[model samples]
Target: MAGKLNEKVLLTGRQVFWQDTLQRLFAKEGWDFYVLTKDFPAPEEVFRIHNVPVVLYVLDSQAEPKSWAPELNEILAMCREHGVRRFYLLESLEMPEARLELSEKIASAWRGGEMTVSFLRLPEVYGPGAAPEDGLAADWLEASQRGESRTGFMETEEKREFLYADDGAYAIFRTIARDFAGESLDIVTGQPVSAKELARTIGEVTGKPLSLSVSEASFGGRLPDSSLVRAEIGWSPRYSLKDGLAMAYEALQDEGESWQRSARRDRRINQLRGWKEKLVPYAENLAGALLMVIVAYFQGGTTVNPAVYFDLNFAYIGAMGILYGKGQSLIAMVFSSVILLGVLLRAGANAVALMYMPEHLLHFVAYLFVAVVTGYFADARAFERQSNEWHAEQARERYDFLRSLYDECVVVKDRLYRQIVNSDDSIGRLYRIIRSLDSVATENLFTQAAGVTTQVMGVEDIAVYVLSKDGYYLRQKVRKGRLAFQQPRSLRVEEHDYLKNLIAEKNVYVNRELVKDTPDLAAPILYQGEAIGVVELFGLDFNKWSLYHQNLFSITMRLISASMGRAYQYEAEAQDKRYYSGTRILREEAFREILQELMERRRLQGEMPLGILKVSREGRSCEELDSICGKVTRNEDFLGEHQGGIYILLPDADEKVCNMVMERLAREGVTAVREEKML
Candidate 1:
């Protein structure tokens, strides 16, 4: 709002109350904020045009909350594609008609380890600029001071939670200050007070007693459980309903009436959509200028002053502003100059007509004028494009430059790369060697060696273990034959003796039993101060396999190891997550594992056909569907979300029973595409 954030925070909300409050709070906190009233990040230009590191969406969908559901998916996809590392979405948990069990189920479905997408359901809001419907606490305070009772929104004995404006700001600060792993936190004070209790507390704080009024009998339970939120973020609001009501009373004593009087503007559609609206008129102008001129030319006007027919080129000049730097107006002006000159030099001109040719020179001058006007504005756009490219090139060069701390290893890499393609001036054969090694997968490392490579080298087997992403472990990715390893998956650097740090060269070990008359070659493959894998060779007759083959083997190792290292590095960064930023729904692998275990358990107990039902949300509320399943299904029924659907695996249950469950779920509130599969 004022200063800059540490990085840009994309705030997607149109409300003046909360957005304005957050802007004031985070302005001086070294965070730059950019608001997107519309959350679609299409054309990439909507988001890629900015350096947004994080997206914070404040969803105020109290009215037609379901309508915004589809937009959220689109916004999230765009955010993910643009490499937005994290998202923090805040909305209220309480829905007007949502039952306690149903709403909790929906919220739980939205929970999980997709750490990038977090939805924080804040407590009932009240502050300086609270909306009319949202000003419960503020309204209560005002009524208490005037000894009047306001009761339409309040139900007798109904419980609700409250957070002050300052506390809401504080909660927002803490939410963004730390990293959350796709967990929904309820920013509540953990205390739920009834309407009468709320009014009494405010009355005591305001020093004015309120006359109690309960016109009807109604029951409202306590607020939703937010203990999970408090535990996950390790944050607790300092304001209780009593304390917050007192703060709201004094600070918002006279402000409530004013805030309620303030008119609420309708949410704005993305104003950026207006940018392309110019294309329509620009296309029309081009067609209007060209189409009419072509018709005029065909109607035979070359001998006369074509200036009248070509006057539409001025319209083209105006259109140039829409497509600045495209040179459309310049091209038209140049072509018009040709036609105007042709008209002036016509031989059919008589004495009076010849005098008209000099005066008609003003038409040519007009062409030059249009060109200058269009070209001036067009050059501004061209300069901006060139300036952007220049800055980007400089940034790339600066970023790639290292300060001699770790770049010294690049020298070794360069030397090895040169050796692959530069072998004693016979570059063609060396180039072939590099290509063959690159194409050879680790699975075929030995098969290729036994082919044309066997004539040059006799290596029995090859195993590969690339460095893990954390840089502390090595994973055995691929191997041709039976590998000598005790670890099931991977080994840490300090776990294996041969896999220890071998930075300079391959540390070879002599094995006598590899051959009766020959020795085995075994060594830790080293690259960049870490042991990638231990390569071992058996039955290599040094007498037949000369030094040429030994050198070839070294070159092959260099190419293969570097490729493996690069691949492992990419995989670790892209796929490895400390925690997933999605709901606690099972992944495909986890679902399969659970299915197998359940099937096995059922088989041991007895024999039965396992019923597997896959339900696709199909543009419906996934959270609502999840709730229906939880409520209607049995405890033993396995329900997990996979591939954009809820998979319900019920052991010993047939299709008939599955249909019954589906019917019950539909009654509860899930409408989805269902398919039954037997396992």
Candidate 2:
């Protein structure tokens, strides 16, 4: 084996599980490894901090060659500046352009042959959380899992080359350490293991009978030959088909503690709980209004004018109902104005009919006055009914929103529990816990915001990104699910195709083309007071033109921008406090104390629950403080201070109870700032 190289390694791109496992394995063998994430601290900063002498580039098979080429060049330049003499390209599969371009770049950079470049191509890897069912083993395992027959692609009938994840990590380390004397190596066992035999092994391990049917269709695409790898790196897989299957089976059995599991549990609960129930009566009422309109159209009375009045009245009522349900005062006013105009016209026609009679005209005038009053009362009644229905709809919306908020809280709590268990260290761990907790809270808020967009603007997949000095970072503070951030290599925001077109024009760009070409782009997301992102929605019926859509988009944008602004201020203040504290001790301790104080004050002031508790120094637990605080406080005084003191402005509390509570807090050595007044 070659001696280990004294260098730090930076890993990036998809295959997080692979990267994480590699980092762990490398560290165990005394190699410094740093995992580069598309999240916080930015990409270039990762290079600046570690400045590793050797660069290992991991390429995914699906990545665009045009995009990857420039990125590779950038990484190469960075490596050159750091005095790196060697670059290694690790790939799962070969893409013609990516392989050719990368090799050409490496050769150009090493004109004198003083620098070395190597490529390691890996075969099918099987372990825990690994299988073709997951798309990585698309040629074999995935097909088998789907009960499809496949044929062997290789010319040899009994080709055998399979490696476990741990073994692969070990092999990579060994190859790098020796600086193997070859330009390319096949990291595979030369033994032939047929596709049929491998499927049977997996079936036996899973206890799920899988039939292997091999046909000409399966043998269409041949695996890239790795003869160069075998000759150069001296790499050979130790895990056979049976051994790899056994390990994978064990891993699959123990994969219950992942984020996917938690998400699945949540989805199941939502399906079974039956809690998003809407009041059926209001829906029925709207249906009835619609039915009336239909009936009025069919029932042509003695005169067409009377039938017209009935149709007009039905439409007027339905319009009022819709406006009321949406809580739009302007729409309701417009509807009422149209109906009043119709009534005035009808009255004027009746007056002209009674103009020739003397005795009969007096009776007609009296009836006309009575009809006008009746019309006024009828309009008032419709308004009242619509108003009541609106209130009911609002209540239903609020209930649904609260229920969603509760479910999200539960998920956040669970994530926090896992984070706490996996974390190590006091200050850093605590910071992580706080950050995670903040993220959970933020996700809930963003979800609510998304709900608002959906309800008001009929948009889906709303995402908010906060503008940062480096670029746009996901406002994880108000997001749901496993929020991931993507850092653009350049600071020019317009480079992104979607954002580029949106920012170029200062108005909402409705792309009919998006619906036809990219239907997924329909979900509208607002940012910086405009609709920055939108995806085409399915099953939308646009029968009428209404300003409500524009209003909804505008309002959603404003809300998101304001929320992002607030979240930015918060993160900024936190970073500032960390910077000014100087000593790590004072900074960390002060932060914790500040957090605890904020929690307590929020509890007293009935502010929204925002903090998580540490089970140990490293682990965090979500605190169910929603039940503790009956209502969220919107007041500023409770959140303004850095210390952990409760300030009560008790104007409504009973004097005796207030005094008693104050005395108890004092006894407990808790400071309280209070203003006493008679209730």
Instruction: Score every model by TM-score.
Output: 0.35, 0.36
> lDDT of candidate 2?
0.48
lDDT of 1 by residue, 1-679 (tens): 2553376777774364756778777776777777775423322444655747677766654646455555555566667655677777767646454532333344344334222666677766776656546756776676776678665334545777777777787777777767664556677777777767776787789898766655564434336677765766667777767776766676665664555555332112333446456565456545655654574476465523365644554555546533654466665566555554554455365545655676666766776677777677777778888999999989877767753524656654655554443433256554555454442123233223223232234332333445554556755433332322222345576654444534234644454344432225444545465555555454455553455555656665566566555544543463323112333245565566557655544433243456777765656554555566777665445666556556877655677877887787667655544454445
Off by over 4 Å in 2: 1-7, 13-16, 37-43, 93-114, 131-160, 212-236, 256-679
Worst 10 residues of 1 by lDDT: 446-455
Pick the lDDT winner.
1
* Per-residue accuracy of model 2 over 320-436 as CA lDDT, tens digit each: 344334323233333333333334445464545445657545533433343344445656777888899999999999999999899878766755654454333234433433332
Q: How many backbone clashes does candidate 2 have?
A: 24
lDDT of 1 at 228: 68
In angstroms, what RMSD does candidate 2 have relative to the true structure?
A: 31.1
Who wins the TM-score comparison?
A: 2
